[model samples]
Target: MSRQIQSRSYLIPIHLDENHWSLLVFNINSKQIINFDSLYNIDKNIAIISNLISILSKYVTVLKGAQNWNFFQNYSAPRQSGDIDCGVFVCQYANEVHSILNMKQFDIICFCETKIEDSYPNSFYKNDYYYKIRLDRSRHGGGLIIFIKNSFVLTKSVHPENTELIYLQFRKSGQLNNFIYTFRAPNLKEQLFLEKLEDFIHSINLNEPLFIVGNLNMDFSDKIKSNISKFADHNDLINFVKTPTSI
Candidate 1:
């Protein structure tokens, strides 16, 4: 059974007395069996998970050689509002962990139209692996959030007031370029938005490598001939999203 396992971390769904379900994460890297129970019943579920770990550890020791396994229970996982949703919560926890693991491949991740308000604290989105920066939505429509890997030493630049833009400047970070600008254009105030965006673009240092990303909300069709395209062309910027967003 150990030979069949390829991943460094694996999940075990434990069935409790044919009625309830819980999850056990065997993280080989950490040498710990972490338990995630949607019910959050520490007194009831801890002993069951520990006994299962004790039984499983014997097989693991025999197959992979003698090893010390730590048991971690009462993990801060989401709890189910009703009794019938334990299985669904388990699936959600698995998917969330998988996504977090996969996110290790990218040095930076950007989110647009987040709809997150300014009242939320930075700790709300905190992760041990990445430094999170959030730009609150000016109006009720959209917000921006950026996650940069902790390995890089970077500084954020001042953005235009009352507009949806986040400017980050990286210094002495090898292979990573100068700046990253993320924005979400307003659906209303077309001309005002364009004017501000154009002004911001013009202020950028042409010598440095700059990446402009996020929703521009413009049709790039040849027949439409949008001002957004003209702005891009004038600045010598390329549109990488080739496919039409909508029919």
Candidate 2:
């Protein structure tokens, strides 16, 4: 199986019992065995993961070279809301993981009653992307991640030391130099959110071709909209979208 698939990672789905489904991923490049069990904790599944690793190591040791396997039970895979949904979550997570690893931009946001924990579905894994920046606060309902193409030669120019804002500088070969900022403010405290963001924008090189985007979460009637405009005017940036993104 290792020789057949020349990928650094492989997602293997297995049916455990009549109703339960789980996933096992072999990350050969990282020498890690990533196990995903929706119903069980990491410690509970370590034995199963260890046994599987031992069996596979025999066939792969000769073809893929010898290495020690590190067991990682993904507690981040979605917990099943119902017994039947485990299979569905596993399929979706696997697809998302494969897409992100292969560098296909998947913009669809999947929401469910169960919290999704796998980093691949969120495109958080540093795979084939050349330059990636992530400002993650999964608990706070605010996070931003950017993936630059591996073909692009990027030089970090304006990375802020703050997590609330994502400011990156990149220069693509034979392409115009660009500055990108992805912003996501708090839903409730709009005043302080814009103030900090405005301060951040003031500190960066705004004269270049700048692309600023994110889930600002600011309503047209909200006072934060006015502050956003004020900041835009001060920095000569344009606010192109006015419609409410959510229904």
* TM-score of every candidate: 0.55, 0.48
Error at 190, model 1, angstroms:
3.2
RMSD of each: 13.8, 15.3
In angstroms, the error of model 1 at 103 is: 3.5
Instruction: Go through the candidates in order and give the clash count of each.
Output: 0, 1
Please, what is the whole-model Cα lDDT of each candidate in the order they appear? 0.65, 0.56
Q: Mind giving the per-residue lDDT tens digits that candidate 1 earns over 1-247?
A: 1134346676766655434567777777777777788887657766666666655665554324213567677557788877666655665666654355355766777765554677766765577777777777633346677877788777655556877887777654464354545554444565677778778766766576777777666777777778878877887888776655422
The list of candidate 1 runs beyond 4 A from truth reads: 1-98, 172-180
| Candidate 2, lDDT over the whole model | 0.56
Candidate 2 lDDT over residue span 1-247, tens digit each: 1134356676666544434567878777777767777886456555655555555665554324323766677777678766556655665667655465464443222221122233435444546644555554443134455656666566664546653555656666565555555544444476676667777766766666776666565554445657667667777777676444422
